[model samples]
Target chain A: AQTVTQSQPEMSVQEAETVTLSCTYDTSESNYYLFWYKQPPSRQMILVIRQEAYKQQNATENRFSVNFQKAAKSFSLKISDSQLGDTAMYFCALRTRRSGSARQLTFGSGTQLTVLP
Target chain B: SAVISQKPSRDICQRGTSLTIQCQVDSQVTMMFWYRQQPGQSLTLIATANQGSEATYESGFVIDKFPISRPNLTFSTLTVSNMSPEDSSIYLCSVALGGTSTDTQYFGPGTRLTVL
Candidate 1:
């Protein structure tokens, strides 16, 4: 069994500033994937960024990036140059592809982010 | 990235009734999944709809409760049977466009079901 934890229940960031959302997971599997998903007010789940456990380098997608520390079992998301549109509920998810097991995602409770102007 | 749409974006139904939500993807996908997001909670995978086979459900979920239909690679439906207030949640449909195990998945807008 795997579990993802987002310690922060809510976060706020001023416009044009940067914000970091923390995430940690527990998994025995060596090969896995970590993802950050954003659900806006419209209720649309959007993929923010993803990190492969095997990759030592962090994953960056424009303003969204991940600080993945495999040894510490930590994967945090950083949103740079934050805008009002970045306000959303962010969730961290983990997925492992172990043999004979279905590919499913285990998500954290989520952190509601508010970008204040 | 694939375009996924779910019909009946939001619905308010009475308890004991049922609601069937349809998911359609613009392109054929390798895998389709259903998830539930309760209020103020994160997403929990309900089942994986496999084409030409029975849908595989996760722990605490059953076929009778969430009957899923995956007729093809691009279309699927999930019916909430004998709904209750506890069933009030956002149901999302997602798809994996690639065959790799680590491929990214695209999500639909989600169908909001309110059981009153």
Candidate 2:
């Protein structure tokens, strides 16, 4: 079984500033994938970024980047130059690399990020 | 990336009523999944909708309560049976373009069901 934990239930950042949301997970599978999804007020789950465990280098997309500490089992997301549109519920999820019935994602509790103007 | 859409974006139902949520993907996908998100809660996997076979449900979920049907590669439906206030939630469907485990699953807009 895989469990994802997001310790911070809420966070706030100023406009044009940066913010980092923390996420930790525990899984037995050696090969796996991690992801950050943002659900805005529109109730749409949008993919923010993804990280592959096999890759030593961290993954970045535009202003979104992940600080993946494999040994610590930590995968945190950092949003630079935060905008009001960045306000949303952020969830961290983990998926095993194995096929069959275990392809579903195990999501964290989620953190509500608010970007203050 | 895949574009997924869900039908009946939001609906309200009385107890004991049943609601069937539809999920449609713009392109054919190998894997489709159903998930439920309670108020202020994270998403939980309900089942994996197989293209031709019966859906594979999670530990706490059963086929009887949440019957799923996947008639083809681009469409699927999930029915919530014997609904109660507890069953009221935001139901979403996700699709993975590739059948492989490494593929990223993209989600639908979701159906918000409010049971009265």
Candidate 3:
């Protein structure tokens, strides 16, 4: 079984600043995928960024990037130029492929982020 | 990315009742999944709806409690049977278009179910 952990339950960032959310996972699989999802008050889950375990380079999507340390089993999300719209609950998820089973997503508890103006 | 929509965006149901939530995708997808997010918690996958076959449930979930129907590649429904106050959570539907290991999933606006 794979488990994702987000140690921070709540985080706050000033507008136009940068913030980093930490995430760690435990998995025996050599190949897997890591993802960060954002859920606003609307309850809409949106994919923020994703990183492939095999890739040595981190994944970056505009202002959102990840510091992926495969050896350390750490995948952290960084949001730059944070805006009020970035205020949401962020969750870290892990997806692995099993030999003869369906691929499933395992998620962390979540970190509530508040972008203060 | 695919557009997904869920019916009855929210509903307040009495205990012992059932609520069926519909999920529709704008484009055909290879896989559809159902998830539950308990209040103040993260998302937990309930089942994977396979077209033309029975849905595969996760551990702690069963067909009797969450009956799922996947009639085609773009439509599916999940029914919460014999609801209880513990079932008061947000139900979400997600779709994976490529059906590959690296394919990203797109989610629908969740259905908020309140059981009293």
Clashes of each: 0, 0, 0
Screening candidate 2 with a backbone cut-off below 3 angstroms (N, C-alpha, C), the clashing residue pairs are none
Q: Give TM-scores of chain A for all candidates.
A: 0.97, 0.99, 0.97
Clash pairs of candidate 3?
none
> For model 2, what is the alpha-carbon lDDT of residue B80?
98
- Identify the leading candidate in terms of lDDT: 2
Worst 10 residues of 3 chain B by lDDT: B96-105
Looking at candidate 3 chain A, the ten consecutive residues that score lowest on lDDT are: A96-105
Give a tens-digit lDDT track for model 2, residues B20-96: 99999989887899999999999989999879888899889998999999999999999999999999899999997
Q: Per-residue lDDT tens digits of candidate 1, residues B4-83?
A: 99999999999999999999999988679999989878888899887998888988999999999999989999999999
> What is the C-alpha DockQ of each candidate?
0.77, 0.90, 0.75
Q: lDDT by residue for model 3 over B1-116, one digit each (tens)?
A: 88899999999999999999999999988688999999998998999987998898988999999999999999999999999999999999999755476677889999999999
In model 1, which residue pairs have backbone atoms overlapping below 3 Å? none
Scored against the true structure, residue B55 in model 1 reaches a CA lDDT of 89
Candidate 3 per-residue lDDT, tens place, A1-107, comes to 78999999999999999999999999999988899999999999999998888999999999999999999999999999999999999999988855234368889
lDDT of all predictions, in order shown?
0.92, 0.94, 0.93
State how far residue B58 of model 1 sits from its true place (Å): 1.1
Give me the runs in candidate 3 sitting further than 4 Å from their true place: A98-102
How far does residue B47 in candidate 1 sit from its true spot (Å)? 0.8
- Candidate 1 regions off by >4 Å? none
lDDT of 1 by residue, A1-117 (tens): 899999999999999999999999999999998999999999999999888899999999999999999999999999999999999999999888652344688899999999999
